[model samples]
Target chain A: MFRTILLLILLVALSYGFWLSPDFKEISAGVAIFLFGMFSLEEGFKSFSGGTLERVLQKSTDKTYKSIGFGILSTTIMQSSSLVSVLTISFLGAGLIGLGQGIGIIFGANIGTTTGAWLVAGLGLKVNIASYAMPMLVFGVILIFQKQKSIKGIGYILAGLGFLFLGIAYMKSGFEAFKASIDLASFAVVGLKGLFIFTGIGIFATVVMQSSHATLVLIITALSSGQISYENALALAIGANIGTTIAAIIGAMGSNIVGKQLAGAHLIFNGITGLIAISSISYLMMGVDYISIYLGIADDDYSLKLALFHTIFNLIGVIVMIPFISKMVVFLEYILKDKVTSNRGFDSAKYLNDSVLELSSTAISSILKETKHLYDNVFEIIAHGINTKRQNIISDKSIDETIKDKYSKEKVDIDEFYNHKIKGIYGEIIEFSTKAQSTTISNEDIERLYSLKLACRGMVEAVKDTKHLQKNLIKYSNSTNRHIQKEYNLIRQGIAELLRSIYIISRTKEEDVVLLLLSKSKVNMEKYDILSNGTLDRLIRADSISDEMATSLMNDSSYAYDISKNLISTAEVIFGDVENLGMAMSKEDIDLILDKKDN
Target chain B: MGIKKFIKRAKEILGLEDEKKESKKKSLKRLLKKLIKRKREICTMLKDKKSKELQEELDIVSLQIKKGKKILHELYKSN
Candidate 1:
């Protein structure tokens, strides 16, 4: 409701301003074009983020300094701090980076955004930049029409740069023209009162624009044209810094708790930085003048001076806040805690979110993580449904001993467990996967996603199979018939062994060990089917068990076989090498290895 | 060189020709090396205290090593 009212007010104001002055219309159009350019630029950059950018982000954000450096470097290259913030939140949601690391990146991005001021005041105002805009737009549009992903990405980038240059030229001319008609400098207030008012204006403009970079560019252009006072521009720059956190806060809205914590950190950091800047404005301006003189910027060059001031103050903010990131993390955790949903209510997907859906690699990474989360629940559910404890399976105990450790005397409520733990997440993974498939990802990623979907299906199937096998497992494990009891015990042993193997495979870093365990589990899975091995036939022929016992044993054995097969295949899909693209081993490969061994 | 031969050579240079086959061969070689090492370790363990599980593992590793080697050889031969 508030957003709608604001939008209507903005439209009325814009229309009224356009009627009052054509120059106002031009400046507004320039800002519009500039914002559109920023959007295009971010879109262009995101196209390549499918892999290379993702890899760099993962490798670079291991430490605080490195995370900050990554934040600065990526924002500088993409020229959009908002994009970096969104990506950081996505990474947090996917469990890719920690809160401290995220804080570092946000700090770096603050410093990074100052480079835009330097670019605008130094080159954009000086050069005949509109001349460059023409060819770039032409080439960019041409490339955008191409079929290849990279080409289209390049197209958007080129067109984005072109539009930005064109927008700047329009804004500069519009301001210069508006100066002749009505002196905006006359409207400028002075001293602390002026500082507070302009700072408020800066925050409001940036909040509405949603890009501090855009708001900063506007302040710089207006300052260069003498339409705004130098002190007011400085206040606006400080306000823009504070307003930028609004982007992070908005990005955090749909993200997980970690993302929200990082956004809170961004807000608190920037707010404190803004307060420090406003309180010490005189000292900062003197320092800026001293540095500007040392750097040979003229006394009248308020625009360049503003850029220097922007960089220095943000650097000070980062320096001041870096030491407190940990404490801030604890503070944010205190105030805005994650809702404790795990203990009560239907368990939902943790990693799947709108932010991660921005990049293909992130989307896939989060989906894979969510699948593992689902599998964790599956492991516990299947373990307990079989009357075997999860702790025993994960322990370094022998399968014989592990299978003997019962989860409970009574059968576990599999239906209730499934509804509580598995169903909601399974539905979400499928829905998110379908949504992700429509994005600009490669067919290979889509195939991998399909395989992940299959893995989820298999996990669900395994749980259902456990439910079917549970009744008989409980009944026969305690039966007086020794043969039936022994067979049921063997079924438990086979499942326990497979579960142990999968757990090992998921944890170990060694590819060789993973392969060996997967292969070993494949071999062991064959042992679950007594019907195939003729053990069932011998038991029947020897009259060791009754016909009813034999039938029950046969059906339960089939379910055991299915449960083992599904879980093994799920492990292979989720934990397997990327080179395989989730391609499971064929039965022929297993049989060939087995047949040669038998020979 | 002719266009086809030039293109083929370029693909080879780029490591794009029969990419799946090359990757499979590489995977097989890696698996075989590991399998051979595991088999040796199993054999060494068997000498001190023989166990049915260890024996079965030795057989499985040996069979995999042999099969991987054969497949890898076929991949090379086809190339």
Candidate 2:
């Protein structure tokens, strides 16, 4: 029904223009060139600022207001909201930013994108911008050929300018052609029919181009050429706002739960705003006229009015919705409910959604979430390793029997299938963290990333140590020597204490609790030393302990001490500062015991 | 002599009429004794042993021992 109405208006307008204006062909050609130039400019800016922009977006802080500010600033700088939305989806998928933060950034992004509309409107009203556009294109082409990095950057900026002008030129030319046609002119002047027709035109154009800035330029050109009135242009601007939200929704479809919620919020924000603007058409037209008269661009040029209406609609939307942001968030959550069977594995690349990278705020927050998941997974694995006792560390005989008797051989292919399944998840997290860090993140974000990376490394090291301890325990169990058994038991207790301390420190977030645990770990280390030294002295006096057993016992004691020391240091790094490392080591001072042995 | 003869005749009647049954049963019992001798050996190498030409032979022996144990337990229950 909407399409049928829109087509009738275009047909009437085309017929009227055919009988009216002269030099319409020249004008159409100019508008085409202008539009081409604008597209080139937008593309060039994207190429020049892609990686650094993505990095900053991935490291967004938790503050909601800060994310909103970042969204606006970044979109304004990049001149595209689609990019911002895609980046948001990526971050949400990676679990870097919460749904609320993503929504705020998207909202800010919408406002930032209007800067382009205003720029186009201002340029359209003035003396020919095409005159400047040609030179930019020429210089841009030359710079594109240059090999130097700085030259390339300049080339990109020039190309962008050239494209911007070209887009404007094309828009101007198209409107002129339409204006000259008598049929088009008469159709455009058909009052209420014309208003709905142009509004539909604006929505279709913006949706097709995936850019509100481009659509606004076309509307300004049509109005300036006298093909449409100020009132119809305002209606079109309203429709354009609704069309812009489509890009965000498309970007969120491939993302996870949080991303879908953000996309839903974007739609609601734009939809409500569009509804209000459309319903108050007369008021909007009055405001646009007032701005046009004040700006002295009211004469045939409707560009000023277009720019004013765009700004007014956006500003009103922000003001009306700002207080109800929490409600909007809840509504979005209700719409995009969490999937029941979603995979929980960490994926860093998902945070780098190609679309959201254009919008830096959402991208940064997504990256932060991915890093947190990586840290948590590594911590969980380490805790599991520490808790697994020696008896259970050996492959359980009952499980093996069950596998052999009941399950198929294919199901028990341990090396080919089981190991890969477990390690693949870890590999993905590491890969993502590496990629995220490679981007130009802020110092604070870098600190957080570094902390997570280090925590993962510490956990991995702890697991390796535990495996080594398990191997030694198996060896001792096999050897029937009573002395070896006794030594193994003693070392096992010390190692168990060390593992407990590491697990406690890793799980804790509170500084005071971590400090208390570190002190207790130090006390355990002191007891370990006293027991080890006493056992060594007795062996030396009796000459009963074998050289191999003594060596093994010594290695075990040293490992215990090293592990304890590493755990304490890890805790200190996490909690920040510790008083002393050797506070309670006087009981079996290893150096004094060694000196007595030498004597 | 009388009880032993009766048991041997019963074993022959229940599909153990082959000449290798007595030697297979003896070797199977020895393997079981070795396995139960220590926990470490049972944990590490119960399913990890290997042989080149005699690998199939070892498998057959192991299976035979498992079957013999099951049959002996059934016989004891009946008695």
Candidate 3:
């Protein structure tokens, strides 16, 4: 009820300013200052709230409506929808939140964003808010320089004041420019063409500024400047609401199904509301005008009407859409059907939001997720390499054709990209994770990140070994020497066993399952050792195997053992105590042990 | 004088002395011994891989061997 009355008051003030205000620039400036203040206040509040906001987000795992409510409350406090959306994506990627839950959160984010718009609209009517901005700025600077945590609150207060005035100043300038135009009133009609034009203007403006709040401030400025009527301003406000969905859409494009779905729900909510608002523009204008007259505000006061329209439209949209969330989800699923199966490949960019970096714990979690994806990619490449080798041995024509025609090129591309491109990305994540670790991250998060980094490094080393083995196998296959072929086959068998152990360890989450696989890998190492010793003994006896063949076999054996050891060590890091795992040994040790055995 | 110099060069290239032969054999044995030590190293590495230790270690013998192989290839190419 209070919200409705507040909406009505803002609408009347807006209408009066548009119709009767002699100083259009001042009115617009006032609105801008209010918006800037609201934005700064929200940012200040977010820093003050810190982990509490994240904790609130973590508790939002209930149904969609609850999640949306949580999203609204959190984003409202944080004051940035971009931060909210990026955080939501990170959470979704981490499997902390479901698709439906994320959708609700995003929906809530849209609503939360309107708090800034409303604050601007309400405060735009005031004549003397700018007087307070300077003192706030001064106090904020003092707080910033105080070097004490308690004093930072003063800085936030000052920043909020400064931003409010700055916002007002720009808004005033825009309105003055608009009002000074000779034919401003000629553009005030609120028909279908007007609606489309205003909507397009809103979306384009929001996209340009990358902030819906900025676009809303501009709309208010134009309304208060007498450049647009209340009806046209309302149309533009509705458009701004829809335009805000663009950020989430761009965010979802490169992300997974859950991200796309969450983004889709945001679009569906806004798109539907946009359609409804456009259709009911005449009625909504009548409603705005009727309320304005009741409050004794003239039709020319466009700023107040625009703010009221913005708030009422979103509130009504939420009320209407809240009941049909499941339907909306289904609709969004249909609309973004292409995202369901198309493997656009994983994007870790969602975790790269600068806002999240300010919060160390969330940033650490994001880094860990990216590192996990990197490890998965490495495992995929190695598995595919093994598959290629197996297909070669069986001489499967279809397999050979697939490898040569399709996967061979892909393998090279992946190798080049992984080795050259992703190494830096992974390294940056590690570096960031390390820095973030010094901040306020939990012990468990730190351990997870550390373990994940080890796993990624191991996988990278394993891929390098696989690449070398691939080159050696190619050479051995082409040589056509029977003795070399036998040695190659033996070495390949050992490598196959090693890969199998890695595959098993990766697939199972149970510690015992990994431990069992590690034991098997150990047994395989012993077999490899016996094979190495036999080959060396044959070489010493001057058997049929050439010296080159003996050397190649030894190299291959050593390589396979090293790769297997790296993989098993990675699994142990994930499952066992990090301290119990002995330090890594060198390749020369394998040869030395074999020589000692021979003696 | 030219013939003597040529003969000396040939002897050096061929490693003709008994002492040189013994030393070559000893070096070969040492290389083989180092290569054989890889068995234990392989086992240890496999253990670490299974356990998944995260620390970065430099100057590792296997890594050195891998490095040595690259240097040897470069020398072979230049020759």
Estimated TM-score for each candidate: 0.91, 0.60, 0.50
Q: Tens digit of lDDT per residue, candidate 2, span A56-86?
A: 5656636766677778887787676766666
- Model 3 preserves the real interface contacts to a fraction of 0.00
Question: How are the candidates ranked when ordered by lDDT, highest leading?
Answer: 1, 3, 2
Best by lDDT: 1
- Candidate 3: list runs displaced more than 4 Å: A1-63, A82-102, A117-162, A165-210, A215-236, A243-268, A281-309, A322-457, A464-557, A569-599, B1-79
- Chain A TM-score for model 2, please? 0.66
Best by DockQ: 1
Candidate 2 Cα errors over 4 Å, as ranges? A1-72, A90-97, A138-154, A181-183, A189-195, A291-300, A342-384, A387-424, A430-465, A471-599, B1-79
CA lDDT of A387 in candidate 1? 83
DockQ of each: 0.25, 0.00, 0.01
Best prediction by TM-score = 1
DockQ computed for model 2 against the true two-chain complex using alpha carbons:
0.00
Compared with the true structure, what per-residue lDDT tens digits does model 1 show for residues A1-599?
98799899999999999999999999888899899899989988887776667778889989999999998998888899888987887787777887888889999998998999999999999998999999999988987887667667878999999999998888889999999999999999999999999999998899988889989989999999999999999999999888878866876777777778988988998999999999999999999999998999999999999999999999999999999988987788799886765557678898887777778888999999999999999999998987888999999888888877787888888999999999999999999999999887987789889989999999999999999999999999989999999999999988888888889989988766787788778877774579887999999999999999999999999999999999988988888662272223457756765665567
Put down candidate 1 lDDT per residue, B1-78, tens digits, no spaces: 974574567456644447567667777777677778888899999999988778767766766666667667778899
Q: Is the docking of candidate 2 incorrect, acceptable, medium or high quality?
A: incorrect
The positional error of residue A166 in candidate 2, measured at the CA in angstroms, is: 1.9
Query: What would you estimate as the lDDT of candidate 2?
Result: 0.57
